[model samples]
Target: ARATVRNARALAQALHDRGFDVLAADLGFTRSHTLAVRVEREGGGESVAQRLAAVGVIANKNLLPGDTSPKHPGGIRIGTPEVTRLGMGEREMVRVAEILDDLLHRGKPPEAVAAEVAELKAGFTTLRYCFAAGEAAYRYYDLVGRDPP
Candidate 1:
């Protein structure tokens, strides 16, 4: 829980520093494993979420003030549990923020960012904070199909 929240806060701060409208930033962004980025543009949440997915960075479309329907929202929620469990720390959050800013803010191609995302994932192949020390994260998922013990 501590690492999750810490990573979330770090990610939020980094995103915010990169000119993103991170929700509840004044209140330390959040105290949970998640943080929200409000993308109050024409396409908004769904659009941003899809773009991130194309770059191999997963995020969920979230409703915000301008959102009129669940299918179309104005925010994207990013969670930290998976990365945290993969032994990522605040430093990695900085790199994540760079990817987001490049893709979303600078209009970088998803293909270009996908390579960066894949490289980052490859660096953290083991699980931490859960499972036995030195356990393989992806293999554990493959063995269980879902849920972790």
Candidate 2:
């Protein structure tokens, strides 16, 4: 829980620095793992979410003020729970923001961004806040039937 809050705060700052209009900036960006971004100018929330997902940055389309339909909202909701569980910190958040900026503003290809995302993800395979520290979160199917290595 603590790591989630810390990483979420870092992500909010990174997103703000990369020119995304982060909501509730006056309230220190966010209190939980979720951060809301207004993406009405670049595209609607749904489109932006799809673009991000295509580049391996998963996010959800969300409704902001003046938005009535779920299909076409005005904001994108990003969260750090999974990454935090993977033990990412502020630096990773900044990297993620850069990836988003490249994909969203600089017109980078999704495959290119996905390469970077994969590299970043490779370093954090062990999950945190569950099991023993440093234990692998997922076990291989072949190994599952055997004794612990």
Candidate 3:
């Protein structure tokens, strides 16, 4: 739990440093694992979310305060819990920001960015913050019905 909080702060800082306008910066960015960033300059939240998703970085399009339309929100809400659970830390957050910058700002192709994401994810396949270590984060669908040996 403590580690998650620390990682979240680091991730938020990393994103902010990479020129993403973090909402509520006056409030220390965030108290929880979630960080909301205003991406209206690069593109609206939904558009940016789509672009990030294309490159395997998932984030949500969110409606900032005073904004009404869900279809065209003003912010992208990101969280670090999943990555934290995957054993990523502050340094990894910086790497993620670089990938995002390359994709969104430098016009890198989705395939290229996705390869980078995959390479980063390769080392953190086991789940953390759970009851057991060495457990696979994802289940093979074909093996779902089989019992563990």
The candidate maximizing lDDT is 1
TM-score of 1: 0.90
Candidate 3 lDDT over residue span 7-102, tens digit each: 767777877888888887777888888888888887989999999888788999999986778788999889888888878888898888889888
Per-candidate TM-scores read 0.90, 0.87, 0.88
Which portions of model 2 show Cα errors greater than 4 Å?
140-149
Best-to-worst order by lDDT is: 1, 2, 3
**Residue-wise lDDT of candidate 2 within 40-134, one digit each (tens)?**
98698989998888767889999997888877899999999888887899899999999988888888888999999989988988877666657
Per-residue lDDT for 79-145 in model 1, tens only? 9999999899999999999999988888887888998899888899787867575787767567768
Local accuracy by lDDT, each model: 0.87, 0.86, 0.83
Q: How far is candidate 1 from the true structure (C-alpha RMSD, Å)?
A: 2.9
Candidate achieving the largest TM-score: 1
* Model 2, TM vs. native: 0.87
Q: What would you estimate as the lDDT of candidate 3?
A: 0.83
